[model samples]
Target: MKKYIIAGLLAWLPLAITVWVLRWVINLLESVFDVLVQGAAAILPLSTHDVLHQLVEIPGVGVAILLSLLLLTGIFVTNFVGQWSLRQWDALVSRIPIVKSIYTSVKQVSDTLFSSSGQAFREAVLVPYPHAGSLTIAFVTGRPSGTVAEHLDGEYVSLYVPTTPNPTSGFFLMMRRADVIPLAMSVDEALKYIISMGVVAPTAEGLASAPQTTRPAGL
Candidate 1:
């Protein structure tokens, strides 16, 4: 009886969690639209308020409207006028003290991660981290910069060492290029391994072989 119950739970657990999450997200978005409609009601003319409230109550319409706005924004940003406006907005933010610090830092990270030229996590790599005789999975995040490059004599590569179960928060390390062990596996396969805490490692022979490491003597 206990075994049957456990098996039933195991089968339904994923479905239940997925449904819960979807419902929660939908409710959260609906609440935002509800608040907006309330505010519009308070200030808008009677006809406009009625239309806005009716539209807001339509299921899934709020998300569709939000997506349409984002598409329109992207279209606008592709033109010269939008680019100038963006520059002006950026300048205004830069003048603010604390906002500039937070905004610039986040913008830099987002650009690096999402830019077309940026190749961070483009490949799976092996690095002898923490100590020798042990290997760890790392993603190539391009070359080092600034003082880190100067200190390393400009020969090191930047890598993001993702922790198990949570890849969003990870450690950044700069190691000599020679210390990096390039793996044959693709980036997706490596991420799966990390997300599963290594339980879902790829079975391909390419990943099974240990990559050769050729470190520079100075390091």
Candidate 2:
């Protein structure tokens, strides 16, 4: 009975979580749409108030508008004028005291994670963690640089050791390149493994492709 119950839960859990997330997002978008409609009704002529109110009655309008805005913004930013304007905008924001500090930090991290040329979180690796007896999965973010690199004796890479079930919060460590073992699993597969708390594992093909390393004495 317990085994059957567990099996049933495994079948429905993912669907339930997915539905919950979608519902949350739809609710948020609808709320934003309501606000926009209300704001427009307040500023526009009384004649246009009915039209704005009617828009609020339509479902998914907010999501559609949000997507359209994002698409238009992407198109705009690709142009030379838009690029220059973006730089100017960044410069303006960067001059503000506390806001600049927060904005700059987030921007740097976003660029590093999302940029086409950036190496952050590109490869999954296995490394000794907590102790030499234990190994954990980590993502190779990049190499250490600047003053931090000056004190290091050899080539070292920065890694992110994501905790099980919550990849967002993790420990950052710098380890020698020679010590970390590269894995054959893709980032997506690695993430699934981590988020499932090792219940989901890489396929046999992926494990077969991983480079074989000689185990130290008892390990």
Candidate 3:
């Protein structure tokens, strides 16, 4: 009886989560769309507000409107005027002190993670972290910068060591470039291995072969 219950739950769990995520996204888009419509209508008249409120409330209309707006925004942002406007808006935000710090930090992360030219998380590496003789999987974020780089002298690789079951939070480490061992597996494959706590291997061959390491050498 217990086995049957567990099996049923296992079957339904993924589907349930997918549906919940989609519904949540749709609801959020709908809320944004509703606010935009109300704001636009406010300038016209009270009659315009009544009509738009009803229109925006139609079952899936807000979702459709929101998607259309995103498409238009994508198209517009590719043009010169839109680019100039974006720069202006960014400059305005940059002058806001506290908001600038938060916004810039988050924007930099988003750009790094999504930009085609981004070097972040482009490779999986093996490093002896926490202590010597311990091998851990980390994603290459890029090279070290500023004072940290100057102090390290030789080439160094910046890496993100993600935690198991929840990969969103992780530690950042800077290690000697020579000390890092590159992996054959892709970033996605490496992430799966990490998130599963090594129970899930990154492909049969990639995980099976032992990677070479480096030492502190004569200093």
Highest lDDT: which candidate?
Answer: 2
lDDT winner between 1 and 2, please give it. Answer: 2
- Each model's TM-score, in the order given? 0.79, 0.86, 0.83
| Candidate 1: RMSD to truth | 3.5
Question: Could you give the candidate ranking by lDDT, starting with the highest?
Answer: 2, 3, 1
RMSD to the hidden true structure, all candidates: 3.5, 2.8, 3.2
- lDDT at residue 159 of model 1 (Cα atoms): 91
Query: Model 1: how far is 145 from its true place, Å?
Result: 1.1
Candidate 2 segments exceeding 4 Å error:
1-5, 31-50, 208-219
Lowest summed lDDT over 10 consecutive residues: which window, candidate 1? 210-219
> Can you give the lDDT of residue 57 in candidate 1?
69
Q: How close is candidate 3 to the true structure, as a TM-score?
A: 0.83
Candidate 1 to truth, TM = 0.79
lDDT of 3 by residue, 81-121 (tens): 99899889889999998999999999899989888899999
- Please give me the total number of clashing residue pairs in predicted model 2: 0
**Candidate 3 — what's its lDDT?**
0.84
